[model samples]
Target: MCKITEELQQIAAELLKEGKVDLVLGYTKGEQEEQSVPCIVTQPEDASKLIFDEYSEKALSKYLLEESFQDKKVAIVLKGCDQRAFKLMQDESRLGREDVYLIGVECPGMKWGEDLSPFCLHCDYRTPAKEDVDSLLTGADIPEAMQGEPLDHEDSFTDINRLEKMSKEERFEFWKRQLNRCKRCYTCRNACPVCTCRVCVFDRENPDYIDRAKDQMAQHQFYHVIRAFHVSDRCVSCGECARVCPEGIPLHLLNQKLLRELDKFYGEYQAGIDEVPTPLSHANADEPDFFGKEGKA
Candidate 1:
């Protein structure tokens, strides 16, 4: 058991005992599995079940958007990426600040099989010091070894570099090949925190963008392009899309490409910073002209 769990449980119990929050949302070991899943504990006794680990991958912030949690004071556990999502939700008015009691934990790079999520690998905000958090818990103190040092922002673009080395036609063919394997299962979109919508345009009944034949090329272009565009400005690069893909497609590559382009074209802007709105969410009349009139066509 992590020491942080005990501290977090103590804090949550205090909150519940004093009626600070109605429910405490945290991770607990799932029945019949080694992985952890989100659990809501209303009673202090249930706080003992709370746990956290690498398997704590599901973004707890996802619950904020659900109708049931509205107008309830809920306590939530947050990793760095999850914290970003929560901040974005609050900024966009999707979730009210008063309704949430945050318990932030310092994240030490969660590991996927071969690669880490782009957000975790390049995270500068691993320590949870957000003003909204009622309390914070860490496995270790802020060590001199960890403090004052810059985060590792080394580019994880090995795959992107390889693709860039290819000719334009070759690069186009590569993506077409990869996307042809898509089953239109929508696992990627469903897993993404930013892909929230009442009804996704992909599955709209009357007006269909995809054809019945599902032309392999059209399928690839439509799904990937639409996914990329929708998340271009808002993606936190959590890698949930690629992690949930059944076919093991490198969907993060497409996301990273868009992230790189946004950084280059606009400025260094992260998706869910509370102080700054996303670049795509706002327009400036004095924007630079990358494509001059002569270069337009």
Candidate 2:
């Protein structure tokens, strides 16, 4: 067992025994040999069940927002991206800061060796800052063994680049090939922590934007674009969307493209930095226009 896993178990044990939290949200081995699943433990004795490893890819913060967790004093283990989402939720009034305790872990970047999730490759926020968390289970410094050299943000967009480089006819052919594999499973949307609207606009009953034709292209376009737009400001780049995709679509690329755009245009603002406001959520009139509309005038 990893030392970090032991430490996490010990901390969870202490929290549960001391009545510091009503529940502890963490990960344990799933039914499958290679997968890890989120588990909510309420007993101190069950703290031993918690595990942390490369397979622990799901963002635990999503469970915090569910109705089951409401008003309960919860302790959640957060990787850097998960912490960012929690911060964004707090900022947006989706969750109260005082209601939950955060155990910040210094993520040494997740595994990218075998069938890597797209978000993991582009993840910039691997280490959680002590100032941003309730309590630091791990120190501020990343372990030398765990740090992978920073990845070029642009490298995650191979499909996007391929699309851009193709002739218009070829580009249309490429999307036809990819969209043909889409099963309309909605697993990608469901796994996303940021897709928390009570009634998702993609639902057929949505009067605001309903597609009477029910064309597959419209469904695919609407689902992907609307989901991306909703999470543009608050996405933590946790890779959950891609992880849950049965078709193995690189959905994180779309989210990361928006994140890169936000960072480029709005400066380096991460979703969970408690001090900085989300870029789209707050705007400044003095900021330079990246869209070039100002220069034309």
Q: Summarize candidate 2's per-residue lDDT along 188-254 as a digit string, tens digits.
A: 8777766677767777574645354434776666667777888887777787777777776667767
lDDT of each: 0.77, 0.75
- Candidate 1, residues 1-41, lDDT tens digits: the string is 56777788788888888899999999988873646788999
Of candidate 1, the 10-residue stretch with the lowest lDDT total is 140-149
- The TM-score measured for candidate 1 stands at 0.87
Highest TM-score scorer: 1
Worst 10 residues of 2 by lDDT: 138-147
Task: Quote the RMSD, in angstroms, for model 2.
Answer: 3.4
- Deviation in Å, model 1, residue 228 alpha carbon: 1.3
Give the CA lDDT, 0 to 100, for residue 138 in model 2.
55
Off by over 4 Å in 2: 112-118, 139-148, 208-215, 274-276, 283-297
